[model samples]
Structures are given as structure tokens and as C-alpha cells.
Target: MNTPEPAYTPINCDYYDRLEAWATMRTVCLLKFYDEEGKEHEVSAVIKDLYVLNKAEYLLADNGLVIRLDRLIAVNNIPVPQSC
Candidate 1:
């Protein structure tokens, strides 16, 4: 019998923060966050703004709607953030 090692992928919080900042500046961008069950979700929006941290989850805003970051998985590439 052979044993396998566990793989790992580091998550970059700074990258996420940059993406969030870009989105807030009206820069078109996507966001991916983890959900309660550790599910990945891709959300598309201008990433309006960073919702202040709530009691349980990292708050996010998209197209005027607020959602928890944990509920996201992967954000597809989007045009660079730009001022409207």
C-alpha cells in the first residue's frame, strides 16, 4: 500500500482586499468567497463596497446587494477597476 501526502494552496487575503478595493472604485471585478460548508462561489458585480465585518461573516457588497464573503468561491477575471 502507498500513502499520499495532502496538498495545500495558500489563500492570499491581501489579494482579496485589493480586489475589494478595486471593485469599490467602480472597477469591474469578480469576487470569490467561501460559504458555511466551505463551498466556493463566484459573484459578479462592481463590488460596490466593503461591508463592515458583521457578527459572523465578512460582509460584501455587489450591485447594491450585500452578501457574506464566505459564500463566494472564485471570482472570474474582470476588466480593471476604473472610475465611472
Candidate 2:
């Protein structure tokens, strides 16, 4: 007899939508995410673009950082510094 594997659900779109909104509006946000080894990390940057390919998603930041959407834990609004 063969055994069946468990069903897996994909991550929700709320996180992606919120992030996209922030990116489109050029809003700065502090992001929290867990690394592959379950280590938590945080960073502050302005969202520059959102990308979706197949079932994968990513966020591009102005600082040339690429972040996976599924790894995101939380997003906090931040104020952007003004130029003199």
C-alpha cells in the first residue's frame, strides 16, 4: 500500500498586497523575517518594486536588497529622511 502526503497551503496574499501598496506609494517600512535556519532579522528600507513569478514572490528595495515575501514576519511603518 502506498501512503499519501499531507496537503500544503500557500501563504496568504494580505502580506503581499500590503507590501505592494507600500512599495507603490514609496513608503518606508521596517521589515522582520526569519532566515532559513529560523533566525530572525530586521531591516529598514523603502520598497521599490514587487515581483511575482510562478508561485514565488519578492520585494525589491531601494538599497538593492531583494527579500522573499513568504519569509516576512512583520512590517512597521517608518518615516523617510528628507533631503536638505
Candidate 3:
């Protein structure tokens, strides 16, 4: 059975803007986030795209990883606020 996705916690607008800027500039960033099972992961890749799917926002990385915005812990050492 497919597991239901966790409720998306909207990120701060300023952080979202930063992500957009990075994607536009193709900047390589260190991304830290939690996976479906709540495992922490880190990767360095350029942001390729940002899109919404099924009402959840996600970012695609140059390395072909798609991460939900709510799952992100930090980008480039900048911590993502827990509250929206």
C-alpha cells in the first residue's frame, strides 16, 4: 500500500524566494531534508525547477532529486523556519 504523504507545512516566503533565485542562477547548494521515513539526507546540487503537485510544492535538483518544500531543513546552511 502506498503511504500517505505528510501534511505539507508551507515554508517562509523569503526562503522560497531564495530557492527561486538559486534556481534562476543555477547555483549549486547544499540541501538538507528529511525523507518519507524521516531520514535526514544532505546533497549538493543545483536547483533545476520548482513546481506544485497535488497541492504540495517541490523543488527538482540537477541530480534528479525531487524534494517536498516542507521537508527541507536547510539550503546552503540557511535554516528553514519551522513555522510558516
**Which structure among the candidates has the greatest TM-score?**
3
lDDT of each: 0.51, 0.68, 0.93
By lDDT, the best candidate is 3
> Model 3 RMSD to the real structure?
1.1
Candidate 3 lDDT over residue span 1-84, tens digit each: 988887878899888999999999999999999989999999999999999998889999999999999999999999998654
TM-score, cand. 3: 0.93
TM-score of 1: 0.46
Error of 1 at 61 (Å): 3.4
Prediction RMSDs, each to the true structure: 9.7, 9.7, 1.1
Superior candidate under TM-score, 1 versus 3: 3
Instruction: Evaluate residue 15 in candidate 1 and report its C-alpha lDDT on the 0 to 100 scale.
Output: 51
Worst 10 residues of 2 by lDDT: 75-84
lDDT of 2 by residue, 1-78 (tens): 645422222346655566778888898889776655569888899999987765566778899977666666777933
Off by over 4 Å in 2: 1-10, 77-84
